[model samples]
Target: MLRLVLAVLFSGALSLPASADVSIKRLFGKEQRALNAIPQTHLVSLLERSKAAKVSSGGITYSRDWLAGQPKQSGGREWRCLAEALYFEARGESVKGQFAVAEVILNRVSSASYPDTICGVVHQGTGRKYACQFTYTCDGHAEVIAEPRAFERVGKIAKLTMKSAKRPLTKGATHYHTKAVSPYWADKFPRTATIGFHHFYKQPSRLSRN
Candidate 1:
């Protein structure tokens, strides 16, 4: 089942149509609208980076060494937003934790309750005081990526996570907070996974009984 799913996604990723302008916008825009209009060049850049990491039969090994070996990665606006979020929020976390945080952002993109794009989800409530999805966005401090190596590590993770098939690492979690403090919403959302220093949660379903 997993291989079949991976095959389908891989096929889709490689199925660029013959055209003068081959681009992710042409290939996946209809399906992955949450990515918004990713520039053609950014998609090509990601594909180039993917070539450096040969697929292993044993599957992904989450470690700094593994991430370091992957080619340095960058992408358009959406990818930058996700990469920055991981750098700020989960740089200190284990590889799995970093992926888990990325999962939350992606989950929010999938959910109707939040914005449809990665940048939109990451900066959902910016501008007003105390109204942002990610603290780094609204925390008043500049989003300075001072640590180039850490940024590169998270950038690679962001690249892979964006391409990864929807996995159960966070079990569909859309929210999370470090274990140090409990937010008011923590008690309300169902806790899904506890990984590293974060506790992940899935927002309650909003189905209405008529």
Candidate 2:
């Protein structure tokens, strides 16, 4: 029976859609005894170690030493877009602020209402007056990437953010504005948190609209 259940679990895991959470959990339930044999704290530690390894391998250790280390080569176009957005938008803000901005950009990408790609989300409404999502993209000033250190720092942040699928800082926020200015849209959304120079918000639910 155990062998048969193990076979079913493996087969179900392989056959089901990767995003099918329910089916995956159902299959996992079949092996609960085996999984439960591992210590919970040990499992959590292993997961943490795996996440740290991914962060380290991407040349972002989430530390000053790593940021001060020799910069890795600039990544591909998607990475370049995200890094540029962060550099221009939040370079002067605290590191946590930069991450928060990056998180909002990424959260927008994942959201149904916004573009699914980073560059698309970052550069949305490029030519329209007072219509761009990110101010730097449409401010009409040449985007001269003059600050090498700042660019390098944000590039690493972007790389790590894309590689790690978790967004811990923003609490599912998809929008933000600097403390210097309050946008009208901010009042409609639920304020999530304030980090550094920026204020974050999550989209309001359908019930909230009514």
Per-candidate Cα RMSD to the true structure, in Å, reads 18.3, 15.1
On residues 97-155, what C-alpha lDDT tens digit does candidate 2 reach at each position? Answer: 78779989999898878889999999998999988989999998999999998898898
- Rate residue 181 of model 1 by lDDT: 96
TM-score of each: 0.70, 0.67
lDDT at residue 166 of model 1 (Cα atoms): 61
Output the number of the lDDT-best candidate: 1
Which stretches in model 1 have alpha-carbon errors above 4 Å? 1-58, 207-210
RMSD of 2: 15.1
Q: Rate the local accuracy (lDDT) of all candidates.
A: 0.79, 0.78
